[model samples]
Target: MSRVRVHNFAVSIDGFATGEGQSLDAPFGHAGTRLHEWFFGTRTFQQQVLGKPDGSTGADDAIARTWNDGIGAEIMGRNKFGPQRGPWEDHDWNGWWGPNPPFHTPAFILTHHPRPSVEMEGGTTFHFIDATPQEALRQAREAAGDLDVRIGGGPTTVRAFLAEDLVDHLHIVVVPIVLGRGERLWDGLEGLDQRFQVESVTTPSGVTHMTYTRP
Candidate 1:
């Protein structure tokens, strides 16, 4: 079976994955790009996300490069897809990632309101469905075939999968900042460390990269 993995997931020292006031303007809410500032400096992010040639080829880039490794499909919460809540008022808003998304595989969006799948340019077709974490993983795993399925997250989506013990490998980047308010990643998950063999390494960027792999 293909493994369920999360990569380059950033959280503050206080465990908040994203800040409050999420809207069309603020994708990470008030958190803005603070959580992912460590990533932006990497060559992997510069090339893959920003389509740039120059970036730091340091320790951060080494781990960030693994984000797309063997990932055949992705499962993200509706919030990660866009800020629109309730029924999607406008289908014209494809996603934050322009016409061509970075995910070169099928990306499933978990939402209460299911809509027809939106096919984008870079081989990413977004499928919206209302399902539990298990059900959504089943669909994503099926689409993934022999390759692994990635749990692309907002805090809620990652927390749900962690709560259900669905994740096989989790890579969390603990940024040094403290956001007192916002969506937290470790709210209900207590003793989560017991389930996985954990390892941590602090990079030159001042972020601690923690990997939790199931034993």
Candidate 2:
């Protein structure tokens, strides 16, 4: 079955998904980039960006491989896509990722502004959808075909999906660091009774790879 999944998402020791004061210079917010040290040192990420296999093949590699595999479509919130608030410009602004982005599948970006579909190399088409998370997921699932729908988020996006209980699986990489302030993954989650079971946990280079599945 086609399911919504958050794979290889990094969270700090203090439970912040990103650092505060996000800007063009700091997309991940302040020192939020440090949380992704595990991914940056993986062979999968190196190969995806540099076209070279010069990274480790241990726990980090296993987590990276799962996150990077068979993703038919990706859904990202406006904040995650770019800092652009209002209507997007022409096709000039592609994305943060360069020419050949890491994601090779059709990516659905959630935003209030609407734009035509953007076709990029390696089969990455950015589709701007002006709708709620549920609606976006429906469209993404259709676009994804047989592959799983991956939620590429910036905290708020994931929170919205989680609130709706639409996520089937969530794989978070808990990094050993602390961001004084930033976007948090579990904030304002009040009396809502939600439960998840740990599927697996592996330590690769001190980074803890945790997978949780809805029960």
**Best-fitting candidate, measured by TM-score?**
1
Q: Per-residue CA lDDT of candidate 1, range 1-215, in tens?
A: 99999999999999999999999899998899999999998899889988889999988999989989999999999999998889878678888998889998999999998988989998999999999999999999999999999999999999999999999999999999989899999999999999999999999889999999988
| Segments of candidate 2 deviating more than 4 angstroms | 190-194, 200-204
* Sliding window of 10 residues with minimal summed lDDT for model 2: 191-200
Worst 10 residues of 1 by lDDT: 85-94
Clashes of 2: 0
Model 2, global lDDT: 0.83
Give the per-residue lDDT of model 2 (tens digit) for 1-215.
Answer: 78789988888889889888877888887874698777877788789867787987887887778885777899998888887778666657788887887789999988888888888898898998888888999899899998999998889998898888888888888888878788888787663335677765757467787787867
